[model samples]
Target: MATPSSPFSFLGDLFNTIGERLQPPDWAVHEIQNRAVLFLNHVLQQEPEAQQRLLRQQGRVVRFQWRFVTMELVATPAGLLDLAPAGSVPELTLTVTDDSPFDIARAALRGDKPAVQIIGDVQLAAEVNWLVDHVRWDVEDDLARVIGDVPAHTLGNAVRRVVGALRQFVGSRTAGKAGGSAVGPAGNAE
Candidate 1:
């Protein structure tokens, strides 16, 4: 008896309430953003080529947007990322094309790329694409540094297995939603 928009409307209201309740203080949000930048720089450091690319992009800014969230990052000469100053214009902007965070997470878990809309500089976009295609976090290596190599290897393997299982389960559920056959990201039955 419920209308098609009912569920979506409920979800929207629920998210709004949650967002209002979970909103952090300005300082805490700034700190979290700084930490994210540090983590990104850490990952960038792992790949010399990526670092070099970023270095080449020094002084340029890239704005990223995912629905209501927005962050503008500036490329530092040291091949690191820093939060851009307020009101700074970005050389390029990357907008996540997907509206659903659940779908984005599922696609990421499946090792698939989320759709994006690129605006502005082509060179900057290409450099960003290269960084995305190349940079990866070596979680196992970091774990090994904290714990031990053997434990880290075992943990990493276990995590990978669990992720694989989840991917399969989620994929199957999505397929079921699409009439019992696997559906591509483009909604094509596969």
Candidate 2:
């Protein structure tokens, strides 16, 4: 008889095979990175303190690495970030140390920071850390700009409730997986 995990394992392997066969083109990757930079700058613009910090570090480049992917961004004089020119050296580099995507996603869902190794400028590192810790995307406000305040608020509340339920479910599953027993909402183990 097939185990409960067999289907998931097969799906994972299938996805990996597909991913290996279909690598995104360079232009597609570059466009995606540019979009990410634009989104990041939009969020940064909403936070004056974060913008000021970036302004102070203007012209400094930060490189982020996760597995095979790398992104290089430089702080601009306007207190925004832009993709660093190809072949430009970064002043600082941060490499994600955790190898498992599942573990990284779990940590993110738990509001925990993923492990990373930082190399180079300490001041720049500190500023970046501060930004990570304090700055948040104002998703509801952005939604309100499109859908109006009341609908945005309703949607935000709905999202929060769903996220809360998901967190609880994931937490329970994690605990159960670690303990070798299913955990219930009331904290009972079976």
Candidate 3:
């Protein structure tokens, strides 16, 4: 089984820093657990810490909702943690769904929490592969927020941002001296 989240790893330090900030109402603690494993693939893009990260991210989104109890993985050093309530999970229609490894992984990283759950009947367009899973929802929603409606161009923009972030992240992980960093001998490949 996986360990607790890296984000929460710093919670002790965090709470200590703001211990006297505010106390929540008793009723506020009553929440339902609505988290999952795949939604985090987009945020981390590593595809390994699916459950721990995605579930946390999910928890965060639903936290402020009427039935809040989900965590989410933000693309920061500290992975999954508390998220604001997501309200109702939106219903997005996936063109494909077969529940295969890729399908499962996609759903794991892409399915909405009780929202647009990608089933095994829909199909995935090749272009969809370019996006990070967690950010996909935000990317989709962001475009919808900016433009009165989602045009073909907006979808491209979202994908572009996801790809850019992914490339930048991966680049840093594998960057060289030319990239403004040098790999230590232990960090370098044999």
Candidate 4:
């Protein structure tokens, strides 16, 4: 008897093919980068220690690359991040090692950091690592500002549960593949 393949297995290949062939326009990429910078600044502002740490690295550029996309950000004197000017040389470069979006997403959902290749200034890399270890966006607080505290808390709990379920499901699937035993949703080997 032959095992059935997942219906969604083609999605990974489909996405990779599309990504390789279809590059977004420069203007759109720039706009998205600007918005990302804005969001980063907002999160940094919420953490005073993070700001002070970034302030220590003022004017230093950090470049992040994943596949074909890259973004460079410079630490400002005010402790916020801004998009680095085009052609600006970076003190540190961090490239995500994962080539597949599905793998990256799975790792993230499992609360694992994607492997990264770091090159450049040691101190800058340390600072970036510290920021990564410490800085997290308080989505619940942001949501509370829009909706009420109770609703935000409830929504946050719901989302967390859903994410937890996804993490378990992904973990089981990975384990089943590796161990050569199919694991059902209830986590029993079939």
lDDT of 1 by residue, 58-144 (tens): 999999998767889999989889999989999999999887666678898877889999999999999999888889999999999
Which ranges of candidate 1 are over 4 A from the true structure?
Answer: 1-13, 20-22, 180-190
Global lDDT of each model?
A: 0.87, 0.88, 0.39, 0.92
Error of 4 at 4 (Å): 6.6
Model 2 ranges off by over 4 Å: 1-16, 183-190
Candidate that scores best on TM-score: 4
Candidate 2, residue 131: CA error in Å?
0.9
Off by over 4 Å in 3: 1-23, 31-146, 150-152, 155-159, 174-190
In candidate 4, what are the lDDT values of residues 1-190, reduced to their tens digit? 7766554557877888899999999999999999999999999999999999999999999999999999999999999999999889998999999887878998998788999999999999999999998999999999999998999999999999999899998887788778888867687755
lDDT digits (tens) for residues 116-170 of candidate 2? 9999999899999999999999999999999999999999999999888878877
Candidate that would win on lDDT: 4
Instruction: Report how far residue 27 has shifted in candidate 1, in Å.
Output: 1.8
Clash pairs (backbone) in predicted model 4: none
TM-score for each predicted model, relative to the true structure: 0.83, 0.86, 0.24, 0.91
lDDT score at residue 19, model 4, on the 0-100 scale: 91
Superposed by TM-score, candidate 1 places the C-alpha of residue 103 at a distance from the truth, in angstroms, of 1.5
